[model samples]
Target: MTANRTALVVRGGWEGHRPVEATDRFLPFLRENGFQVRVAETTEVYADADALATTDLIVQCVSMGEIVPEELEGLRAAVEAGTGLAGWHGGIVDSFRASSDYLQLVGGVFAAHPAVPADEAPAPGEEYFREHVIEITEAGRRHPITADLDDFTLRTEQYWVLTDLLNDVLATTTHPAEPGRPWRRPHESPAVWTREWGAGRVFVATPGHDPDVLDHPSVRTIIERGMLWAARGSG
Candidate 1:
C-alpha cells in the first residue's frame, strides 16, 4: 500500500547532467512500485500549492537553474509540511545557487568537481565528465538505503559538496590528492545522506551525474530504496 504513494518528478536544467535521460531511468521502477508518478519539465510545478500539498514525494532533477521566489517558497512549505523531498546530483542539492534557504532545506550544495583533463575539456558548453570510486561508510552499511550495497567504481564526476552537519551520512568518497587542487588533504565528501525537515524527510545521493551511473545495479538499488524510505519516513 505504501507503494501506492504519489510522486512528482520535475526534470530540466543544464542538460549536461542529462536530466531527462537520467530521470527516465527511474520511471519504470517508480511505476512498478505502485507510485502514481507525475512528470513535469519545469520548476513552475512547485508553485502549485494544492498539488504539492497532496503529493507524498518530490523527485527533482534540475541542475544549476534559478527558481522564482514563489516557486521556491511553495516547495519549501510543501516539504516542511511533511512532503518528502528526494534527489541526486545537482537536481536537489545544486539547484537554486543563490538561495541560501533552499540550500539549508536540502542540507548540502555541490561545491565543485575535479577539473577535467586539459585535452578533455569541452568546447564551452559540454559537461566535463570524469570517473571515481564510491564507498559505503560503516554507518551506510547499516542504513536501509545503502545497507548491503558494495563499494563500487563509477565513471562520473566526483562531486565535492558542502554539507550540513545535521545530515545522516550513508556513504562517502575521498578526493584523491592532486597538486593545485583546492583541498590539501584527501577530503571525505558525502556521497549519500538523509535529513529531516520539519515532518518531512530528505534523501540525497551525489551520484547519478550520467544515466549510466544510475543503471549500475548497486546505484539503482540504493536510489530505489531511498525513494521508498524517504516517502514513508522510515527505513
Candidate 2:
C-alpha cells in the first residue's frame, strides 16, 4: 500500500531505557499501518522546520535529554500547527526537565517512580518494579485508542505523575499512601491521557518502562492506536 502518513521517530538518551530497541519494536507496526517511518537519534530533529511541517506524527523515545531553546520552540510551533506527538514512559514526560515550556505543552511530567512498598517489596534486584493496576476510565472505554480494553495490571515501574486539568484522561493508576510516606491518602495518577495543542493532538501512556513492557499485548495495541489517534486527521 502506498504510504499515506509520515511518522518521525526521535529516539535517544538514557540507554537503560533502551530507547533504540523500544522505538524499533514499533517501527514495523507503524509501517504496516501506512506510515513512512523515519528514524532520528537526536532531539535536533525537532529544530528543522521543514521536516516538522511535513510530518504527520512524532513518536519520541528520548529519556532525559537536553533540548535547547530553539529546538524546543520549533517543536512547540509544529505541534501547535498540527503535528501530532505521542510517546510513553520517560521518553515523553521525563525528558527535557529543565524546560518549563516543554512540560506545559505535554501537560504532565514524570514526578517519580516510587519503588514497591517495603511490606510487598520483591527480590533484592527488583525493588523498583512495583506491581499495580491500571484502570481504564469511562472516557477511555469510548475512546478509539482504549475502547473495550480491560483494566490491566503491570509489574514494572509504576509512574507517579504530576498532571493538569486540561488533559482528557483515559486511564489511571493509583499509588497507595504507605504509612511512612508524605501524602495522607492514595494518590491517583493518569496512566494514559490525551491533550489538544492548538491544531494538533497529544497522546501519552505511562505504562511502557522498556521494550518488554511495550510488547505487552494491551500496551502495544494502545500505543499503536494512540500514534494514529494523535496524528493529523484521526477519525
Candidate 3:
C-alpha cells in the first residue's frame, strides 16, 4: 500500500538514546511496506530543498541538537507542504530543545523523567528502568492509529511533556508516586498523540527510549500504523 512513496529517516545526536539503533529497528519494516527509504545522519539534509520536496514522510531519531535556521525552516516547510512527520521518544519530541517552532509543530516537549534514587542506585543486574502502565484514552480507541490496541505496560522512561491543547491525545501514562519522584501537578501525561500542521500530519509516541522498547508488539504496531497514516501516498 506504500508503494512508490519515499521515507527519509534522519538519525543523530545523543548516543545515550541509541538513535541509530532505534531508527534501524524500523527500516526493514518500512521497506517491506513498500517505501523507498533514505537515511541521513545529520540535519543538513533538511536544508536541501530538493530532498524535502520529494519526501513523503520523515522519521527523525535525533535527540538534543541545534538545527541551523535554514535547515529548520526547510523541515517546517516540507511538513507544511504535506509531508508526514513521525517519531518516538527523544528523537522527535525531545529534539531541538531550543527551537520553539519545532516544538509547536510537534505539539509537545519533554519536560523531565522520573529522577533516579540518589542514595540507593540499582546495581548492574537490578532493574533500573521504571515500569509503568500506559492506558488508551477513550479517544484513542476511536483513532485509527491506536484503535484496536490494548493498554500495555512498559519499562522505560515515562516522559513528562508540555503539550499543546490542539493535539489529539491517544494514550497516556501516569507518574507514580515513588521515591525521588515528586510530580507537581497532574500525574497523567500524553503517551501518544497526533496533530495536524498545515497540510501535514504529525504523530508522536513517547514510549521508546531503548531499541528493545520499540520491539514491543504494541509499540511496533502503533508506530507502523502512525507512519503509514502520516505518509501522503500510502493507503
Best by lDDT: 2
| TM-score, per-candidate, Cα-based | 0.91, 0.97, 0.92
* lDDT-better candidate, 2 vs 3: 2
Task: State the C-alpha lDDT per candidate.
Answer: 0.86, 0.92, 0.89
The sequence of per-residue lDDT tens digits that candidate 2 reaches over residues 117-185 is 788848875787987899999999999999999999888999999999999999999999887888899
- Model 3 lDDT tens row, 1-235: 5658899999999998898889888899899988999999999999999999999999999999889999999999999999999999999988998999999899999998865465657555333466788899999999988999999999777788999899999999988666555555558899999988888999999988887889999999999999989887655
Candidate 1 structure quality by residue, lDDT tens digits, 1-235? 3556789999999997888888888888888887889999999999999999888889999999999999999999999899998999888878888999899999999998876667666555335456677899888999889998889988777899998799999999888777666667788899999999988999999988777778888888888888888884444
At residue 161, what lDDT does model 2 achieve?
92
Question: When superposed on Cα atoms, how far off is each prediction in RMSD?
Answer: 2.5, 1.1, 2.2
Ranking of all predicted structures according to lDDT, beginning with the best and ending with the worst: 2, 3, 1
Runs off by more than 4 Å, candidate 1: 1-3, 116-130, 233-235
lDDT for 225 in candidate 1 is 89
Please give the lDDT score for candidate 1.
0.86
* Worst ten in a row by lDDT for model 1: 121-130
